[model samples]
Target: MFGCIAAGRLVQTNLQQVDVNKYVFELSDPQSINHLVVFLLGTIPFEPGYAATVHLLWPNKDWQLLGGLSNEKPSAIFRIGGGKNNIMMNQPTATLGISIEPIETVQQLLSTLSSGVMKSGGSNLQHAVSMTEVGQMASRVIENLFNYVTSFAVQDLPMNGIALGEVTERGYLPVKAFQTWYNNLSRKLANDPNYLSSEKSA
Candidate 1:
């Protein structure tokens, strides 16, 4: 069924076994979306398209949907907030939470493409073109706002003082020290003849 799913509206129906693994709800009013809450009447995984509608209650009357799990085993409740349409005139900023799969998939796809190119022969013009296409795709995927947040959250935390190990035995340091080391490494990389030549050819 194709129809518009409003940001602040609730939609309920009964289906014996709904497998929403790949199903997605495309919202017509993207900007007006405040929050989406989903309630499942049976045990089910969080489907991609299922969402809940936000209802404004009292005092905190500008009712923002925080996060919650349904009281019943078969039921699931989700709260969505933060979109152009969800903002109130006199409220402090409300954060909209959205969980998106990371761009690791994009990176994995690029890696596969790179492997194919390597197998095909790096000197092949076709392989070069494919590599370029993959790179462009990667850049576009990384630029997506949701992907950016997911990447940041999933990335490994950087170790402290790893850069200053040569100067200090502790192998940990502050931001300024790391910046200096990073700058030096950047300069070296920038001046490397092979790296420059490869970049130019690409």
Candidate 2:
């Protein structure tokens, strides 16, 4: 069972298996999902502290897929009853708690930034990004931006957004997970102005 507490309500979705590289959920409500908790069910094949590459992909302003990676390793033995959400395994398992608010905030901020850049007679976002040396500069800017934003945003969340010490690792890691969730929520909100307006009014 796949479970997440969305909008303070626990929602459980049952699935036998998730394709390794496939996007699992396209959320219908982004704002409602304040916090996300993901559990790795199976035993890992590697030793403790062995890292796994986490991939992330999301469309930019032009809908071009921008990819990123996170080298997340299970560092410590996570105990279930000790407030750690990860299950222990032959190889340690890791849990990632993603707070979606900052992602949305940055998404909105980027749109505003892009507009500001254009209005200031500055070069387009793509043009401002250098294409030299494989060009990770743009990616680095986004990664840093998310972390910068999340630092402040996490302060406002419960327990300071630290469910598990490792779970709270945010910003560009475990890609595709939150990006897919964020986009799904964005699409739903875009399609439902009435609900969006109601939310604002409420």
Clashes of each: 18, 2
Best by lDDT: 1
Q: What are the models' TM-scores?
A: 0.20, 0.22
- lDDT by residue for model 2 (1-202), tens: 1223233232324322345432243333332333333323223423322222211112221221121111121111111232222222222222222211222332333344334121111221221222211223323322332443344433233533433222243422232334444454456557874433342312
Alpha-carbon error at 94 in model 2, in Å? 23
lDDT for model 2:
0.29
lDDT of 1: 0.31
Cα-based lDDT at residue 153, candidate 2 = 34
State the C-alpha lDDT per candidate. Answer: 0.31, 0.29
Candidate 1's residue-wise lDDT over 76-138, tens digit each?
Answer: 222244343434434433332222222332223223433534222221112245444543432
